[model samples]
Target chain A: MKKVIGLWFALVAVALIGMSAVQTEPGLAVGDTAPDFTLRNIDGKMVSLADFPDAKGFIVTFTCNTCPYAVMYEDRLIELHQKMAAKGYPVIAIQPNDPEVQPGDSFEKMQERAKEKGFPFAYLLDEGQEIYPAYGASRTPHVFLLDKSRKVRYIGAIDDNPQDETGVTRRYVEEAVAAMEAGNEPELTFTKAIGCTIKTKKKG
Target chain B: MLKKAIRILGVVGALSLSTFLAAQEEGTPFPFTVYETYADFAPVMAQDNDTTYVINFWATWCKPCVEELPYFDSLHVNVAQKPVKVLLVSLDFRRDLTRKLVPFLAEHPLKPPVAVLLDGKYNDWIDKVSTEWDGAIPATVVYQGGKRIFHGEQFSSYSELTDLLAELKQ
Candidate 1:
C-alpha cells in the first residue's frame, strides 16, 4: 500500500511540472525570424505584420503607457513611425505586458496614451504573449527591426540614450532602417536594452 | 548682519545633514553586517542550504524596478513563511550608495532582505546572474530548491508571484 501511494504522488508531481513549461518562454537570441502575429489597435482594428508588405522594414517595439523609459521614446517612435511609414517603413508598437497584472499597462491605458500622442502606427496587444517570446521581449521599449524580406536585422535598445536623446551616440533602430534602405547590413545591430521589466500573469 | 546670516545658514545645513544620516541609520530593517566583496557571499550559495534567494539587480533610476517594489515587498513577506529569502542587490552607482541609493530605498521604506552590489566591474557579475540578460533593469533570479530561475520581467499579477514560488518549490 505504501509503494502504491508513493507512485501516485510522483505522478501528480510530474503532471504539475508539465503544466509550467506550457506557460511562458522568455529570452530570444540574434538571427531569430520575426514571429508574425495579429493584435488589436487602439481603434479596435486587427493589425498584423502582413499589413506592412510594401515597407522596406518594420520596427516591432514592445512598450507601454507608464514606463518612463517608454514614455521618453514615445515621441521619437511616433515621429519615426510617421516619417518612415511614408518611406515604406512603419513601426508596429505592441504592449506585451499583461493588463490584468499591471494596472498601468491596461489596453485602455495603452489606447489612451497612443491616442494622446497621436501615434501613427498600430499599438497592438500581444495577448497570451503569442508574440513576446518570438521577439524575446524582456523590457518595456525593447525594439526589433526587420528588413524588407521580413528577417530580423536589429534587436535591442531603441537608442543609446533612454533618458536624454540629446546625448545619444548611437541610433540602433534608425541605423538599421538606413542600412536596409541602402541595401546594406546594419553595422551595429544590438544593445543592452534597459527599461521596465515586462509584466506577466501570476500563477494561481 | 550678512556674516550672521551666513553663520545661521551653515548651522541649519549641518543640522539637517545630521538628521538625514540619523534617519538612514534607523531605516535598516536587517541587522548590519559588512562585506567588502561578492566572494564573501559565495560560500552561502555554494553551501546550497535550504535557503531560497531572489537576487535582483536594479539601478537607482530604473522605472520598472520602482514599479515592482510593492510586488517584491509582498514576495518578501510571503516567502518569509518558508526558508526563502529575497536579496535586493542594487546595481546603482556605487558612489551613490549612501547619498542616493540607501537614502532612496530608505525614503521608499524598503523592508529588510536587501543589499547593494558594490562591485565596480558590472560586466563580470552581470553574466553570472543570467546569460540571456542584455543588462536590463528589473532582472531577477530565484534560487530555490537547488535550482535558479532567471526572470527578466516585472511580474505584476498575483499568478506570477505564485508561479515563481511554485517554480521554486519544485
Candidate 2:
C-alpha cells in the first residue's frame, strides 16, 4: 500500500513540474503594445507581426491542427481570415501547441494543412512558444487583434459560440474589426476562448 | 446482418469502455489527499500548522489540467521533504465519482490525496476560490503562511513548480 501511494505521488509530482515549466509572462491586454516575433510560415517565408504594420488591424489566432474544436472551426477560420483580409485586416494563425508532443501538429503537417486548405493567411509556428504569452493565449483558436498603432484593441474568443454557429450570441472578432473600421473602441474587449488548451511540448 | 451490427456495436462499446476506464485509473497519483468539498478547502488550508499547500482544482475533461497532472504528482513526491502537502481537487461531477473518477485514479495510480468536489454551483464557489477567476479550467493556488497566490490556466514545467515552491518557502 505504501509503495502504491509512493508511485502515485511520483506521477502527480511529474505532472505538476511539467505544468510549471511554461513561463507565462501574463498577457497583453487592451492598450498594451503588441509583441513582435519572427516565425516561419507554411511556405517557408519569413513572417513577422511587424510585417503587418500600416494595415488597419490584424487578427492573430493561436490555432493547431488536431483539436476537435480547432478542426471544427477550420472553415470559419478560413472565412474569418479571408473576410478580414479583404478589408485590409489580415489574419495570422499561430500554432503555439508543441508539435513534438502532438505529432499531428508538426510544422510539416501544418504545411500540408496549409496546402490542402489553401490557407488564406500565414500559418506560423510559435517555436518555443515565446510570443503566445504576450497575447495570453492558453488555448488553440484564441484570438488577439492589434490596431494600426500595434496596440491591442481587442482580445478573446474567435466567436461567441463554438458548437453551434447558429447560436453565436457575440461576434467578438468580427465586431472588433467592425469597430475599428467605424472608428470606435470595441464594445467588448475580451472573453475566455472556447477551445483546446495549448499542449506545450514536454521538456527533458 | 444482425450479427454484423452487433459486432460493430460491440467493437465500439469495447473501445469506449477502455477509454472510459483509462481516464478513471489515472485520477489520483500523489501522496497528499485531495478533498473535493469547497467548504473544506479554506478550512484545510487554515488547519495545516506548519505545511505549505499546492492546491490544484481540475477536471478530466479539461485538457491542460490533465496534461499538467503528472507534474503535480511528482511535486507531491519530491517535495514531501519540504513536507509540503499537495492536494488535487477534481472538479468532475459527483456522478462520475465511483464509475469514472475512482476507476481512472486507480488506473493512473495517483499517490496524492484526492477529493471529489461536490459543489455544483460555480457561482457560489467561484468567488470563494478567487474573485479574479472567470470560471476557467486548470486553476491552481499555492498557499503558505495563510497567504494565497492564485494561478489560472495550464502550467507545464518542473522549474515553474519549483520556483513557486521556493518563493513560498521563503
Candidate 3:
C-alpha cells in the first residue's frame, strides 16, 4: 500500500511539471519566422503582412491605447513609420488589450487615438486577443521586428529611454532596421522595457 | 515711502514661504524613496537575509497591478508574526512622481514599504530581478535565504499569495 501511494505521488508530480512546461512556452525569439496575421485596422479594414509586398521588413509593434508607456511611444512610432516605411519597413501597430478587460483600448478608442495623433501607420486590433499570444507578447509596446521574409530580426524595446525622448541614447528598433538594411544582423537583438501587462480576462 | 514699500514686500514673501512650508509638513509625505538607477536599487533584490522578502514590481498606471496590490498588503499584515517582509516597488515614471504617484498614495495608503524604481534601462537589470520576468509590471519575487520564486502574473486572491509564502516558509 505504501509503495502504491509513493508511485501515485511521483506520477502526479511528473504530470504537473509537464503541464507547467507547456504553459510557459517562450515567445518568438530572434531568427524565428514570425507568424503572419490578418487583424482589423482602425479604419474597419482588414490588414495583413501580405498587404505590404514592397516592404523590406516590418516593425511589428504590440502596443495599445491605455498603457502609459505605449502612449509615450506614440509620437516616436509615427516618426519610425515615416522614416522606415519609405525605406520599405513600415510600422504595424497592434492593440493587444481585450476591450472587456480594458475599455480604453477598445477598437473605437484606438481609432480616435490614431486620428488624434495623425498616426501614419496601420493601427490594427487583435480582435480575439489571439495574435499577441501567438507572437508571445506579454506586455504592451513590445516590439517584434521581422524581415521581409517574415523572419523575426529583433525582439524588444524601441529605445533605451522610455520617459524622455531627448534623453534616448540607443534607438533599438531603428538600429535593428539599419542593420537589416546593411545586410547585417542586429548587434542587439533583444532588449527589455517596463510595460503594462496585456489585459485579458482571468482564466478559470 | 519707497523704502517702506520694499520692506512690506519682503515681509509678505517671507510670510508666504512659511505658509507653504507649513502646508508641506502638514500634508502626507511622499511614501516611497525614489531610486534613479537600477544600480542604486539592486541591493533590495539581493538582500541575503533569513527573512522572506516579498517584493512586488508594480506601477500606479498598471490595472492588474493596482488590483493585486491589496493581496500583498494582506500578506504583509497576516505574516506580521512571521519572518516575512513585503515591499511594493513602483515603476512609475519619474515625471509622475509629483503629479500622479503622490496623489494616488495619499488617497490609498498602503501598509508596506513602497520604493519607486525610475530606472529606464530595463534590459540592463530586469534579468537581475528575475530572468523569468519579461519586464512586465506586477511581477513578484518571493525569496528567503538561498531560495527564490518569481511570479510573472497577478495573484488571483489573498490565499493564493499566502499559499506561495507558506510554501516558501517551508
What does candidate 3's lDDT look like per residue over A1-204, in tens digits? Answer: 999999999999999999979977856878889889899999899999998889999999999989999999999999999999999999999999999989999989999999999999999999998899889998989999999899999999999998999999999999999999899999999998889899999897
Per residue, candidate 1 scores C-alpha lDDT tens digits across B20-90 of 67765888432223334556655434447778777776666776677777777787777677887766766
Model 3 DockQ vs. reference: 0.65
lDDT of 2 by residue, B1-170 (tens): 99999897777766655665564477633222345556766575555566788878876666677778998989988987885888887776545566666556645656677766654434446667766655556887888766777887677587787678777767
Ten residues in sequence with the least summed lDDT for candidate 2 chain A? A193-202
Q: In lDDT terms, how accurate is model 1? A: 0.72
- Against the true structure, candidate 3 has what lDDT? 0.89
Q: Is the docking of candidate 3 incorrect, acceptable, medium or high quality?
A: medium
Residues A137-183, model 2: lDDT tens digits: 86677788988777998877777556557757677899989988898
- Residue-wise C-alpha lDDT for candidate 1, range A76-162, written one tens digit per residue: 898888777887878889998888877888888988887788888889888887788777777788888886666888887777665
lDDT of 3 by residue, B81-125 (tens): 988999999998887877777667655668899999888888899
lDDT of 1 at A70: 85
Clashing residue pairs in candidate 1 are A202-B159, A202-B160, A203-B159, A203-B160
- For model 2, the superposed segments whose C-alpha errors exceed 4 Å read A1-26, A50-54, A116-118, A194-197, A201-204, B1-64, B67-137, B141-149, B153-170
DockQ of 1: 0.23
Residue A66 in model 2: lDDT? 76
Ranking by DockQ: 3, 1, 2
